[model samples]
Target: MTFRAKQSVRRFILGTAALACACAGTLSAAAAPANLAYDKPAPTINPKLTALSKAMQPKVYKVSNRVYVAVGYGDANSTMVIGDDGLIIIDTTESLTSGRAVEAEFRKISKLPVKGIIYTHHHMDHLGGAAAFVQPQDAMSGKVTVISQADTMKLLASSETAKANPLFTRDIMTARFAYMFGAYLPKGPEGVVNNGTGPAMVAGPVGLVPPNKLVDDTLDVTIAGVRLHIVRTPGETDDAISVWMPDLKMLATGDLLMGETFPNLYTLRGAEIRNPITWYRSIDRVRAFPAEYLVLSHGRPALGRDKVASVLTNHRDAIQYVHDQAVRLMNKGYGPDELAAAISQLPPHLRDDPYLAQFYGSVSSSVRQLYASYFGWFEGDPTTLNLLPPKDRAQRNLALMGGEAHVVAEAQKALAARDYRWVADMLTDVIRVNPSNMNARKLKAQALRQLGYAEVNANARNWYLTSAQELEGAPLQIQNDWFRGVASPQARVAQFNAMPGRAIIGLFAPRLQAERTLDVHKTLAFVLSDSGDQAGIEIRRGIAEVYTQAPPSPDFTVSTTKAALARLAAGDTTLAHLIESNAATVQGDRQGAETFMSYFDPPLKDWSDLHFTTR
Candidate 1:
């Protein structure tokens, strides 16, 4: 091995050991002052605004004589419509515990049997708690019909499955979730004030029941004697749908149009860029309806004919305004960040309009997403195509900036001037170079805390504060063992099962030792005996090609159950153990098969636990 490679490995090992030690007792070792002045919320925050934000609480709103919505039960809302024969529910809170709370409260208003459930989209918060409303057995037996877009299962499963690239890890995703949801925030005014979606999330296992019926397009149907027109609204997700109750003149728009806040065309937690044109088209359809009342998934119901129309129009106008202006600038050759900065705020007339508040989605993320949707990520800059990786860039930048001390000193000056954003950017490189710098860590925490406190957007605040807690060396339990602690084994296995088999095999290429395998040519045939699905793989010079079946000549064939194979692939078990347990059998050459497994490395990648994650 070269000198630099060996030194890198040693540095990695040492850094990991230091992180473990920090996670164990750093908080006490680097305790903050008994009353850290900067720990308080920013002095500029409006008192009235904070109180109004805290007023978000769980309650049932009667939208009409027949329709009611359970608001703020968790980070989502559930709407129930009572019919002559039974009841129909639209959306459910985030988890089973939260769903049960809303269900109990809903029973206070009506005791009618649940006849059907309508999921607006493929988001977990919108439908993860379906089981709390109705038993799975009932849905499976056709007692209660569950309906969603036909692509719901495929889209939902794709989201939950493992990433094909190691650069995108679940820990990073979970870490982003922690930031977006304020998982690390304390339960009080000082932290976790409100998630724009609702009051807060409830702790419990997520309950999911797959849809039994599918809605492919515009369908006019009746459930439990309630006349409804379901429109496929492709905005937040491809499987998004909206229900319009013609009889009652009520339109139930799920997260399609959120509460007194700007719609999130792009989420910081990472998601596909929402198509602005499609979203505007969907809003226009809702505007065409003469709805007297509207049920939302996060905020209070919009009542009265004129009031609902005005609200819907304002939202539509804002969406179109951003899209139109953004596209015009892109035509003039403005890149994403430039366009984002230019369109920092809405027009004055619409800025303070109740529906256009920057509570959930900010203009920065929106402009970027819209620009990408229209022009794609390439900015016509050739240098960016061959950009340096993060670590290398950080090292070079820090070296040019006269090392960590110079940057930290400048950050201290920025902190003194109350410029939190500058402080964050200034200290980022220093921390990346050496995360063990206690001084830099604490300063960065203070900057993030102040920024989070002063921010108006819920997601931005949650991320800033959560990141602050991390720099202060706060340890998260789930951050340690994500799969075992965050979700059940069955759920994890189901995600793996839903992933395309080709994607599963493609993940192996990055782990192959091309240097060792440059001269070694080998072929392994994988056959799922139970499912009768087979894939033949040939690896040469670290390149892998997969076929529908085993080649005419293969060195060995490994026939096994998908379950055993998934377990081994997940690093949960070993191939030798599977062979010994009779779950797998190797024919032709057992030694060659075992050697093949060794040729390709298992995933052993991890990033720094500090706040600056790649996600």
Candidate 2:
């Protein structure tokens, strides 16, 4: 038989087996008495889960008659639904190793086949291990239906932004690794036992296949005679969605209804700002369901109808409160910073609720995102309207502070006072001014660690600690090859052209002096190429306008891929080899090419002083 045919058969068998197992296991676990108020106030504290479980415990809990939910203690959690016919899964965890662990838990209870998979959103942590649950064949075939919102397919397809922007993604990954697995997830509050068990080793390729079924607004699917409702709501991501089971009275709130941490309205890794108003509205939509149990994508499941309702209500109120308060302050002409400081505390009732705590994101950041969304980044101060470049500003600040030593002293004072935020700000100036100051680097590292330790939000903690670790000498290796495999030259060219004029202009720094600037008097186009998927990009320059086009060759062509251009842009490597090796073929005038290269300013290695300030 052909490979395709064989694969199809394998998938059918797997799907059939999964279904049989789920059906056979349904009778193993007897249903617990309903409405029997178990005096046990929900096992809220598990020493192994304390640090990361503030949102929800890690233990498995019965959400409905047959459906069960197990919150992953590391990375994003996964929710499982089992019925007489088969099983449905939401969010697949970060790695296959962990995926196996999650599957094992389900198997221990039932031998059922997983009939369908639902993605909450397109984040890797939520859908990375789909292959483990449903087998490739089943996914390829129509045996198992994978579902997500209409926009989710776009997000999943373009999710390689993490791989494309390596520098930013690496920094975010470092932070994620440290917080989600290092000491936070396992240690809890008592203390940590460093058995050296790091994050589950994730090997093999990392790509999530698009769901087979797409839902724009709402979708109803009957599996094993169980009705499942999927609804879309804009929250952490534009394509986010939530799942509801009317028959089971269980609601699977992807990342929207995460335990205690505030949503990341503005991710530091670089994404569009999330709408706080819409986020609150989405939470309210989930509350509208007759959900007797709430199972979140990342934390423990909240059991009991009354308890679930109360939690969802409060979750909605918490976000709405922040949104409304921020709007009120904005109306009163309070700036972002002022508004953030004004509402430093949550409502009295929510302040201590484990679900409302800040373990992954903070209200301060959310306030800034809201302000930016409504008013843009400018604060209306003329002095700050057109600020000098960061390095230049650092240099000026250093001179005014009486040199590096003086700035270092101030940073030290801030550190002594435990004002890590100020220390980070002050030390950043010192590093920029005197890049070789070892003392400044050490102080900055310490400040970052303290900031990380104090952060209740996991992402914030990871960012701070990762920054500290990087300063302490983590290798700054850029993975150029990773981008080559996923990035499409044609798509990138389209994106480049589609970018706003201002965004394109932002790419050019005035300080970077090229040999000569080619005045683009008219629009010009160029061709793109790929070096074994390792490099691809369009080379374009003109007097009036310059842009890139996919596939077809332009009037003039520069043969190279986006990866090579990115490497050249970041100053990670030189392009002399490509030119000399004939790897880069140019159709345009050599002078124009030279001018284009010259315009890009060389990256500065010594932008910061370890002891005092930035230069």
Candidate 3:
């Protein structure tokens, strides 16, 4: 089998022997028969995971004289293209701190002014740290060109912007993201070794500067004497784009071909169903580029044409194989779970390639997602349409299994017999019936820990272990650091203040206290003195209807800057204080304006209680 990395760089790759060693150390001990067990080794986390994670160690990979990629400086790789008299930055890392770190390294490479900034997609990992690279004023004035797909901002409105703040689902998505990335787990063997795509998410001030130049299909442009081809390839994201430097023969692929691991056909963290067909076709387009070097946003770069071609082919073929095989089984009357069971592994050729490793994406999960995408959640089973609630079902199951005590006893025996899956399944009922039951929680945590220790997929391992920690109420350093540092109330207030005035007012609709406003009929118009953006809200019946246009006859009008509004929402100040201090002015009834402000819920005091496995 051809390794993805060259022999000299092979140490960067995780060997099959490491995985075998990990299984031999822990899983083998768990499976040993009681009668045959003379001496069992102590349980330990997977060493393969630890070895695989080292690929994210901070280092500047020199692709060529003109291009350099800083990997592991942050969760996402940042590339600096050294052009004559200037520079172009492609995909800033996840946070300002990380971007600064990468910028410092690039300063060592060249001190030329940044002529342009390119975002491959709208993901925070790619664009959030943009502020660290170029000044906002320079980008706005076109002194530095900001290029991206035309649909990037439109897509951002739904997820990354304040428009998403109106939807309660964003909160759940944030919590899931934290869990999927193991954001709260320590960077060690027992916790998170590394993020599947990169190191780990860097939590800090996330900034965004809207693109000035948008790519429709393909654009041929010259920046600082470097001619480049930017092609729109809808793969991992609908707005995904790939950059090809014709002169240098270097292709910079964003998350399209994510790291050395198999492409995440469907991430565990919630996202729109990524079409596998589109993803493979997109790879085919990039395959046409006769690139000598492949610089990726997640993993190490490939140095030769043959090496790059081989890796690209195997990666796309793996995605197509998973898609076709799953659909084939689905046509044969296989359900979601059945399809996952049927297509357990790839073909030997593709399976043997190191690029197709399941370190990030799992065959089972992708297969299940395929089923969901095509057929919805229903599997032609009527019973699933109106099934009993989980709590009620658990209560009934406990009743049938004698009692909670008997169920716990059976789960204990299953754990002893090395049947961790069954133990977890059985204990879910006990936990549901009695959340405070320490015996059930502890046993479930133990089962999950063992399962996590033996799992090679980093995402699944992190999820399992994090869930266990939640059940046991264990403290994590990342959680504390997040709340105290970048994610603090003051920090969030500043973030909100920096958002568009329209977005700040849009959040009002979702935070309205519907019960209190049901009988109240009032209208309030907001005019941002700083940005000159105006929006209005009318409380009628049970809804707070928001409009960009001015209201016909607002009971009162509050004129203030977006910053003051953010502070008011965060409970840092009050409407009365704003009026008294001349920070805001009321054009109409002052009493009505205060009443209008009182109708919305205040910002959350603490987000630490948002757990993945808990209610």
lDDT of each: 0.71, 0.57, 0.75
Worst 10 residues of 3 by lDDT: 29-38
* lDDT per residue (tens digit) for residues 142-251 in model 3: 99989998777655443233323423444455556567767677656567666667766555554555577889899999998888899998888888999999999999
Clashing residue pairs found in predicted model 3: none
Return the TM-score for each candidate structure. 0.83, 0.70, 0.82
Q: Superposing every Cα of model 1 onto the true structure, what RMSD results?
A: 9.6
Better of 1 and 2 by lDDT: 1
Best by TM-score: 1
- Global Cα RMSD, each model: 9.6, 9.9, 10.8
- Predicted structure 1: lDDT: 0.71
Candidate 2, position 516, lDDT: 42
Kindly state the number of residue pairs that clash in model 3. 0
Which regions of candidate 1 fall more than 4 Å away from where they truly are? 1-55, 158-171, 189-191, 375-403, 472-476, 479-490, 498-517, 599-615
Candidates 1 and 3 compared: the better one by TM-score is 1
Error at 323, model 2, angstroms: 1.6
> Pairing residues by index, what is the TM-score of model 2?
0.70
- The order of the candidates by lDDT, greatest first, is 3, 1, 2
How many clashing pairs does model 2 include?
Answer: 52
